[model samples]
Target chain A: MTDKTSAKVWENVPSPFCGIASDDLRIEVCGSSVRVLANGDAVTVPGFERPVTDTAPRIAGEPASLEDAVRRAAEILKEARLPVFSGFGTDVNDTRAALALIDKVRGIFDQARAAGGVRNLLALADSGWIATTLAEVKNRVEVLLVFGSDVEAAFPRFFERFVWNRETLFGQDPARREVICVGRAPSGDAAVSPDGRRPQVVECDPRHLPELAAALSALARGASLQAETVGGIPVVVLRGIVERLRRSSYSVVTWVAGQLDFAHADLTVQQVCQMVALLNKETRAAVLPLGGQDGDRTASQVCAWLTGYPTRVSFARGFPEYDPYLNDASRLLKDGEADALVWVSSLSPAPPPAAEVPTVVIGRSGMQFDEEPEVYIPVGVPGIDHAGHMYRCDNVVAMPLYALRDCGLTTAAAVLAAIEQSL
Target chain B: MTALSFTLKSPLRQRLDASPLVPDRLLGKSPKEIATLDLQYGNRRIAAADLFDIAGDDAESVRISGSPKLDFAGRGMTRGSLIIDGDAGAYVGMHMKGGRLCVSGSAGLYAACELKGGIVEICGNAGDLLGSALPGNKKGMSEGVVIVRGDAGDRVGDHMRRGSILIEGNAGMYLGARMTAGTIAVRGRIGACAGYAMKRGTLLVYGSPVSIGATFNDCGLHTLGFLPLLLKGYQGLNTCFSETRACRSRVRRLVGDLSVQGKGEILLVA
Candidate 1:
């Protein structure tokens, strides 16, 4: 631990926990303890302030050297017929190391957020989508349409940082933007414009979003529907929303994939994307699919660059085979196909899933598991104990992370590389 | 000539890709050569004789005792007959151009996906996206006849260009979605959102659907002259709809999915 007099402040430090990658945080570190002095929210504040409890590697809940733990993990992987690498909640370099290890062991790789990510991926694979980046939304969005999600609840600083900013790159007035919510109401007032204008909320059940999306698409495409009301909302109200979308210079349709919790929810995303595409024929419009928290976007971006597929990849065929359904990590574990599991989550205190097979965990410092894994190696958090790179929710840019403290812990990439060498 | 046979030794720990076992790929090869064929098992390739007990002489007809771990059982076969006696995994008869592929037990996801021309018969229930396109592809089952004797999962005939899918049991949600042209007939109940965003197709439902999308405008009941003709096409297929008594001329015709300006028709048998 460092002396209290050596407390140092870090300015403009980008976050690895929040999906937005908020970069203007001022953090002060002293003796392995961190405090967010400015620009902190519910997500980033807790992320930076979590106590570092575990500092030693263990073999079956008993203290062991890091080398012994890694060797044991490698031995388990070497003897297994099929292994799965899941819960990839680390930075880019660590994820790359994990993928390399999975290929060497002929294992399957999946992320913790793959269930939600796959929903968006299926819609993208079935029918392509027109999407935009955060920079575009911050600069030129005149109208924003949110579907089936409480934006402020999941993303605390989404509106304050992007929607109601003081200024933009262009000369457009940010206070004149229009916010519209459908299916689910916003839990807070963050969506209110700077001029104190409340957003128009179209109240309806989340299950009815599919029909509403379809109706909106039909109306935007100039088709007349015989139904007086669709999904319990008057067609006239939907028409008004469409007219506003048409009249705007630039409009963005956004949604959180995790909030769409119905069967075949990808169809709803597809319908919304189709509506956005149709709106583009007359004016400018695009889609913004949110929810890339827990390093999901980083894992997908890194894996896609290395192997041609995004996630749910298997190297069991001596080549990367992409199957979103067959390669699911949870399904593989439940079906008794995998003989061993290696879970990595260095960003948060998320534990490895309970499995009947032998399991190895390389996770955050304070993760508590219900059942002790075969091997456990506590690692340092990126941006807190070491420098790394992480991808934001938009997936177009990867921001560099700087260390804020001198925590005596190794990085996940180093441990995984050591395990691969032992194999 | 005896039909070729391969019996599984036991349950597999890893999935096996049996794409090379099709008849077109095995013609003129002796039993010794056929036994030496390499199959993908996990990260390595193993000879066919290591896992299966091969026998018989004829290559035109092939029979295999399937496990749930057997995938791509008859992929890209242009001709001949391939039969699976037990459960088959994903991608069964995928990209088949012409032939008869039959499974006596349940089949996994993406069965008959991207099939061009052939007859795929599954005696047990089928998983999701049956007779649909491969991921990122636009067209699915361009020309084929898929008959599922048991219940089928969701998104049946997705983005299909042309084909006929007959489901004897209930069908899950989003039946016949985004089909440009096809005929999907379900004998049992169907889940919500039938004929969603379909540009053109015919969904014949014998049992009441759970829910229909509001976009599908109800056209009332009608006695169509083409109903008998459509039922006659299933005569030699050995399905329950093949019987003459099963032909019902009167149906509640709902034409819509005006969401995509689709001209598809959902015929509910009355």
Candidate 2:
């Protein structure tokens, strides 16, 4: 099912489809890292193309394979739910990256289906969803359900922005509002409310999202929850939480940064959505699907503006298009199909080593250079070399760079400008 | 005033010992006025005119002519361009802001160090830290683009806050140490850490990763719409990034730098 090497033409590409570079294979080595990908047979790189060696396995002009990983996405997506964990087991830095990666992997199935190829696909269609900013959260959201996440680890300012502070609207401080945390494990982020009452804990295995939903439902219905207790909390506290949620004028259900996996989290997401819908029946409420590339939201926002979408796109038809699996870097790396690359970034000691293909680069100043590329372009950091803007974790507009570093290079805007001119 | 010119001299080492290169301050000085230096050769003071002949009178833009083997040609230029027609010295355009400087020939090490904002064009090859911050400083070229037709040495943009960087040729290593916000597109194959310690930034590539650390999780692929816009003017990208009209409806996201609180992302084509 991964072999997408049917030599499909670039034009008339359907929606929800990824693309391989066709018709033009001239590659330029940009100033960036080399990554290998392999999955679908859409494009073949005849060699290993590992980053450790120049003579590893490499085929210069082929697109990386992005197939062979949809099934695994079911498991990988499980990682998207632990943003509220206060332990040492977390491996990923940003939960959004994991979700985006899974979505891309899942996208392979959608693309295959679009091409009339048979594959199981997860339905992403959902009902209306509501969301709020971190600022409004302080005033409006008095009841917080820290489900499957660890705020202490994922968000440094979760308390400062969401919980502990006094708000003008909600008229409540941390002690007044109700904070409930439910996860597979305990969370330090779920500390006792400033009023000296310990936050209720329901330590059920996160995988049993259905059970959690049922518990919440039972509490909402004024019935005794089937489960006696969860996360070491008494059933009475569970009832109290539901009561508080019912009585609150405004409320919010927050997500952890990592719960991107659909296996266990899909039900959770639905439940949160459902809870929002249910809550709205009584009062104003919203859900905050927390976790995005911290500042990458800016890139996502700008990219969306440029290509009318976020994250990934292909330009085979002289226009822009998007497909998750077909464009994922990891899948491409496994596929080993990039002929050359223009790796753009500004957050490393040097470039990321990759397949022995020619490449180009755009990033912060003083980047180390390798001899594999045809060209290297040095750009400025957005705020430092050039003043640019970004979106905070909660989608808030963040402050621009306070000062510019001392040297040459412009901003991403210029690089885009140059790329436009080049095309 | 101080107008440095190396129109055609090779005694740069000896002459450089006697200079007071406050050219901007010497805006209204006479020809026979004074060209001094606050340099120390084993703890000794001298004059700048002793090296290459300083020219020009009232021009705000400083010019260093002649094929002089000068070092530190355009170090820390505040608001100007260094047009060197011949081989020059190190720290070219170091800490520059708002101006265009061109070096017609080859250059020494640490070409453009810690450039805050400006445009520096090195027609020839350059040394290390071409567009990076100085040692002990976490900020590199915060703004501006350094176009190097040749290869760069190493340690570029260490701890940059924001900006865009493009290397026309090749780079040594340690590209972006800890960039908070910005985009860097290398026109050529580069060294390691392309997106290492990135708090938030985008690193695109045409080739595969030579070596990837655990810091960046391998999220799958997703099509981004910004490619064509980024590939617009470059010839190579014209072919590699022809409009496909395909977009990644879903993308895999990797969260790393577990060592610190970071939502920085590094995306690659899957």
Candidate 3:
């Protein structure tokens, strides 16, 4: 005997949990609970069905009114000589409002989920990047190259949403697309293609990604090599991979920037870009640098348009000054350069970075804190509690976030805007 | 042509975006209309007259004197001449299709994003993403000429479909990265990952070069056929390229980026 209630089904709901930003999730809301129907993977369920809790604001571990909380937050910021505004796990509007608050306080701005994004931005800044979208990957990609990162680990539903689809508008057989995994290949069970085909595995050390990428680039360029093996791949095997890419109608080289642990990790990305560029000379090739979870891309996009800088910006001088290496929140806090922190994360359950200075946290409703801060304001979940915009991992398309239910909680933008006004 | 000028009277408290104050948009507008043009200062949207004192009325040639934290000074201008007498802000001459924009002082990031055609010259340093795409766009600076007299920040000529960028001073990393086709010549030392993922282009580095990425191969000493023509194209520009005309077509060419198209070249001044 089970209890079932009438549910309202919503289609094409975009999941902001991962970098893929799959928009095909079908959400079925019944009463206070929700269920993901179409393309509802393990990640999607938890990402959308997060338990709503803590509707009120708190100050010093005690429940407080919204106006009192705003006034207290403004007092902290106004008194702080060096304040770091970080943990940017909110939507586009929230980021804009946070920026406004940061400007008023003359603080530094960074992201909690910024390591991977910062590295990628450095790569992009170091050498320009070439990227493609999910639609392009689904329709045109005939060959896929995954370097140093397990595709499933980062974007769990990547294959299901963009690769193993039952219907492709281009009429290309999904089974025909070749997947090439380089460096730390996934096990047989984990590596099974969605279409039941076997993907080619190039077994190599993940640390040697730079060398492997170099060898692959040399092979793609048709440089005659005397060695039988390069970067642990046989010359013949490398040639075969190159030949397939040369003949592929469209090829895509993808990697998770955060997965790369090399001292000069961007070098590996550069090599991959070079390899893809070479392949494009013969046919058509593009790069898919995936990894922008927790609205990292959205934060960077909003920051760039508003201040002409992506992240790690200091407004202490009354103008946004960008310095990726210097303005890192953790770094500044640890070095005692920053005297306070304004941590904002409306999705992740992760806690704020511990610092000696006073911290004001505005985070997910369900987030649990190990050490209570000076003030904690629980904000609504973007794409669930409030409607907003978030940039996809590709950073090309920005999907609209939909509000599923009327959860009586304040939005991060509203709180931050209020704080600015209070200040 | 008669020149219209706006001299800043005071320092700005915030960034002032003057994208709407382009020459083409002001060509037919009266002096009063020009002063009333919209401008964005931080979150506040103010008018041109609020920031600067306007004098004369010539849209074909407009000059902005003093810095005042102005950005996008000559943005999206087509077929006109604009001059900045002092330091400028970011995105100067951005998306310029056809015009000549001269900045007497430094410029900030994305100075010439997605430029179709124009001549942009910066006498001082330029920030990152010069002649590159906007944040998410694929291609950058498809057609244009960008000359930075001083040092430049990273990712110059990144993902450029077609264009020419010349930096007289040292440049930051990723010079000519992901370039489909273009010409970028820097006389100063370049940071790491120069010509990375370059499909088809020519990156001439006269200074000490940095990591050329493993994808590139030393093609050895070879006489490039395009060098002379390329140098001759900038003959009258009074750049380092014009001074190297005596070298003829001879250059220490390292043809590579063999990883992609292998058509792109990283040439060193012999």
Tens digits of lDDT, candidate 1, B1-270:
898999998787788898999999999898889999999886668999999999888889999998888999899999999999998988998999889999999899999998899999999998888888877888988998999999999989988888899999999888988888889999999988888888899999999645688778889999888888888988899997877776865899988788888899899988
- Which one wins by lDDT: 1 or 2? 1
> TM-score (0 to 1) of chain B, per candidate?
0.97, 0.72, 0.93
Q: TM per model?
A: 0.96, 0.40, 0.63
lDDT of 2 at A128: 39
| Weakest 10 consecutive residues of candidate 1 chain A by summed lDDT | A1-10
Give the candidate order by descending lDDT.
1, 3, 2
**Candidate 2 residue runs with Cα over 4 Å from true position:** A1-125, A184-197, A209-240, A259-267, A347-359, A365-378, A396-404, B1-270
lDDT over C-alpha atoms for residue B63 of model 2: 69
Highest lDDT scorer:
1
Q: Which is better, 1 or 3, measured by DockQ?
A: 1
State the lDDT of candidate 2 residue by residue for A19-122, as single tens digits.
Answer: 11111221111122111232211121211111211111111222211111111222322221211000000011111222233233222111101111000011
- Interface RMSD values for the candidates, listed in order? 1.7, 25.1, 7.2
| Models ranked on DockQ | 1, 3, 2
Question: Clashing residue pairs in candidate 1, if any?
Answer: none
lDDT for every model? Answer: 0.89, 0.44, 0.79
DockQ each candidate and list the results.
0.65, 0.01, 0.10
Error of 1 at B156 (Å): 0.6
